[model samples]
Target: MNDLDKVESILFSQEKRFRLVDIPGAGRGLISTSLIQPGDIILRDKPVILGPGVAEDGTYCSGCGDISGSNLNLMENCSCGLRFCSVSCKQSWHTEEECRIVSSIPEPKPNQNYWLITLRGLVSEDPRIGFLQELTVQEGAGRSKEEDEVVKLLSSFGFKEKSILTVYRQLTANTFRRGRGRGLCAGVAMVNHSCSPNSRVWWDESGSLVLSARVKITPGDEITLTYCSPLLGQPSRRNKLLQSKGFICRCPRCQDGTELGTYMSSIRCTKCKPGLICPVGLDEDKLGWICSSCGFKPNPEKVSGLLKKVEDELYGLEKEKDPGRKLLLIQQYIEKNKKLFSSDHFLQLRAGDLMVGLMNKLAPSTSCIQTKEYYTRQTLKVLETLDPGLSRFKGFQLFKLYQILFEKIVHSAQGSLKAEEQFQLVQDMQTSLLESKFLLSGDRFAPPEIVENANLLVRALNQEQVEQIQDKINQKYKIVKSVYQCI
Candidate 1:
């Protein structure tokens, strides 16, 4: 059988809803054989080969591959110099035989985890290596200093240069970053990329890669994943795709200058305040933008310079430790960029995200609260357009909105609120909570507090304790409304 056929045989041995097929332009991709609903598990795969990515620095456990903060530097006492969380993991995955082999290396480096991982795959007689060999090599892009060091170290161990290069290339091309490291999952590696993808993949606590449908997939649809951040605009996304994945994405979102009507890449026109200047063509490398009104095109360098400045500011804001300082800088940034970028621009969305997070720490006036609400709602709207169904991003944003609504209800309860107004806010809170809970279900990437808070709120809503608060408020107002205000 062919390599893809072998991969299919290995994958189909497990429960899967998709089949591997070659498309015209996009080499090999997975196609759904059956209708797949959002949140449905498309595939659950364990890594055949697991190792550190470029510059990972041995932060993850060698055995069981757990990268949680608590597991770091746990047991560096192994003769092989591999890290392990416990004795059981050391015994289970990193065996005495493997340790002996690793220890026998002529001159091992401090962080030889990359070399060790490549060594395992190189020396192994496992049948899966045949399928792995079919993966693309990271060639012609020039190697990093780390990669060169890895090759030299492996060569010292007396392995063939050809075999070493082959294994190294396959690992680099096909691996997905689980945490501080990457893993080569044969089935998942075959699925191609899209800026807006139908499927999402995350590594579970058990070290298994869980691939689920982010949106509904009818039969014959190609299963795709985003290789880069979905929040990035076309230029950044395209640049990332080309540099890393070896292709420029012409995905539907990438082709559209307006970024699917969200104006994620568009800047507001200076000549006509109402108009947005957007890219004119499909060429990601070329600089061509035209305003929808007044036919004005700003200098490309000027646009790039502005974006770079804002990007640098955002980067600095992200690194700032103090929430208060971060909030101040973000407010300053919003005021500075308001005239330049459209309200729904990706940069603004990022700032909105930062601002939404700061809401928990700072006490704002009623106007500030309303502004936060506006940003939250706009962010949620943009996310819905970018990632439609069961998105982890949307789930977090929903939780933020839920927090805002909850706080608004509490604040209004202190004052005299119209029973109907209070009831609407409570309804919005429950909806956001429940929706977030459902979206965040089985998602390991979501923060623990978000999941916990969502569950708590859902339970409280179910018990109707907040409903009691609403009744008290309603009685005080003496209005015939089944008002549901949070206490």
Candidate 2:
């Protein structure tokens, strides 16, 4: 067999069950031999590459991936002596009975670590929660909760006290240190990384983590998803992965920024004449050129330093009760960074969203006013650039448009003509939402609060009107499915 075939054989023998093949210029990579549809179980191998430390502290859930506090709290250990987030999960575990065998394993010696046991054994348990068994085996004899740091961190993130303790006890019972799980499915682990990935990773109702291509992925494309938050740019991502994963990623996306010399080492010139030239500071390497017209070149360090300051100010603005103040801050950030960032930059897009949200909050009744009309147009422009019809932003902008039109119909002092115009606007907004496949797309990029907010908005809309909208949405979904089948 050839080298590629040899690699595939080794991986399959290791129980990864994925086949490696060449993708022309992309080199050798794993691909699904079976017809893997959206949200299908592509692979379920152990982690080929595990991080140095367990994600003891994070903004998200390690269990269910929920950012909301309403998620279940930790419960007592099940019959198998395994702890879960709640009684529901514990009961579910009971049916599997995988934990019984796992929990019964003898603990390791004082010097032995729990993660090591997992690495050593061939655990044939549920991949979703099977990692817990490794801990169970390692915790063999000794059982002591010596002030759990991970639990404390989770508690600080507003996780329920019981939930925090439960997860901690469970993790504590196993391994406290990090270790890699060999023989993990290459289709899952070998998937590449991207700052703007076309796919999203999600856990279905069955608790199995599934990957869905958010955008159209070519047949031979190396399927990838953003491991880190996309809201963060290059340097932040590198720092995080380095600190947590202990690997300096040489991924194309990461390398691209470094090669461009845009890894927090350059900024646009604010003083440059509108069309003449844009200047950037020259450091160890000449990052960019200086503008001749205004002789403008910003210090890269100074520009990078303002990022945190801008973020802090934005946070404060979000918390402010006065909508005008919030809007001002949003505009201030946008105008100040206009030269520093491109119009299509994610930060600018986010600021545009903030502006629309603040407008809605400030004057829901007058959002369609000529003064606010410009903002909506700007929002539409940004959302279109980001993903056009296949983005959560598109749904949000549509919702905003619906709100503006609805408010005008309800509160306007004008005659029935204005009401008619508003009605047409609402219809247009609904059509836009349906065309975008907003509901079927699933909420990945949007914050949990935003999803909740959208749900509430849907609930508040006129029942008959909503039913009509749902019908249209369903029709559009059918068409989209048909198109995908044809493709």
Candidate 3:
């Protein structure tokens, strides 16, 4: 066997389920031996590396891992018993409790326990703090040399007694959560670097984290997970991940404008038209574009300026008072540029999303035949290109489509539907909900209330339709659960 084959076998044999595989074009990546379907379990691992806990120090807030004290105290402890900078950050941690209790526990070493004791004693004396006393009693009973090293490490990182206690609490709680597992996973140890990754890392409901193929995987694919959520487009995604994770990703998707046939980085050719024609650049590697027809070239500054103007216009329209006027402007802009920019283009997609939002807002309440049919047609056209399983807007759009069709039936049939129409509507709603559930899975940004509402709607649908919706929800749930388990 070749070296890569040997490595792959070793990684996926009975001894191991995963390993880093070398790819020709891509860098080193993780791979799975077994065929993993849409929502199959992959791996459940933890962090092999961790950073210092600065939350409980009162010097740093646990909410966003930000050191800022303002509004930091408002954050509650996470399920893992650690504090985060905010509720959003806490949810991201996927832990059970704030690490306050863990922080109060004594270190399992001779001198180290002294700091733990100090923090615990202070917490105990405060009327507001009886929740962590249990942990204090547990830590006071035993000590270990390893605990000493950890404490010394924390001290070196400038952690005081309060923050040190918090760190200890976080560790202890995570350890307990691990049951019998060893240290964190090597995969999770690899820094998250890109959004449109060749690979994806996910967590399940049970808290296992798993790594899997976000796209197709070959024997030598380098696996990657976006540090930031994938919902954000390329520019914003890259900037945020780089700033927070401290790494600039050179992944194929990040480097090249083409992925899944979408030109994510194209800019309009200003010379061709005042605000319309976009000329595709020489792939994504060579800087600047050579116009296909005119041989005109745009400097980077010009391209950037064009993009800025478009963005500014979009922003201005977002605040416009008249939805109809906004929609008309957007439609005109889209129509003007349709030949130059395909629907898949990022700018065009944004425009389409705005149009969908406007349509939803302006649709007649009772069912105007013309408006209802018009929106249904528009929504279907968009869905042809957009993955209903990925876009949040897709679900709402589908919901609106169904609403329109229902309104049409009501208006024509005088508030009653033929058995066939009823069956068709049920089928459509079920399909839409199923797609939406998958799209919504593992989306931390989507409020739990919204999910619950969607689930309730699914439940109220026809019995035959229920199975399809449940299946989709379960499939996504499994994928998420496996990701958590692997984590």
Model 3 ranges with Cα > 4 A deviation: 1-16, 21-28, 45-186, 189-220, 227-259, 262-286, 291-296, 315-344, 351-426, 439-487
Better of 2 and 3 by TM-score: 2
**What TM-score would every model get versus the actual structure?**
0.81, 0.53, 0.50
Q: Which residue pairs clash within candidate 1?
A: none
Name the candidate that leads on TM-score: 1
Instruction: Compose the digit string of candidate 1's lDDT tens values, residues 15-99.
Output: 7788898887888789999988666788888877665555554456775455535657555558766677778766655655567
Q: Whole-model lDDT, candidate 2?
A: 0.44
Q: Give the whole-model CA lDDT for all candidates, comma-separated.
A: 0.72, 0.44, 0.46
Q: Which one wins by lDDT: 2 or 3?
A: 3
Model 3: what TM-score? 0.50
Ranking by TM-score: 1, 2, 3
Pairwise TM-score winner, candidates 1 and 3: 1
- Residue-level lDDT tens digits of model 2 in 1-487: 8866765554445443236666544344555444333333344333332211233332222112232234324434455433345555334323442353434444531211223122122222333223221212222433234324333433443446554444333333322121111122233444544555555554333433344555544455556555554434444455554443333445544545322322222234467544222223222222333444566655545555675566566667677777787788788888987776645444665676677666665644453354355556555664443232233445556655655555655566466456677667657745544433453344333334444544655676777866676566545333245334311
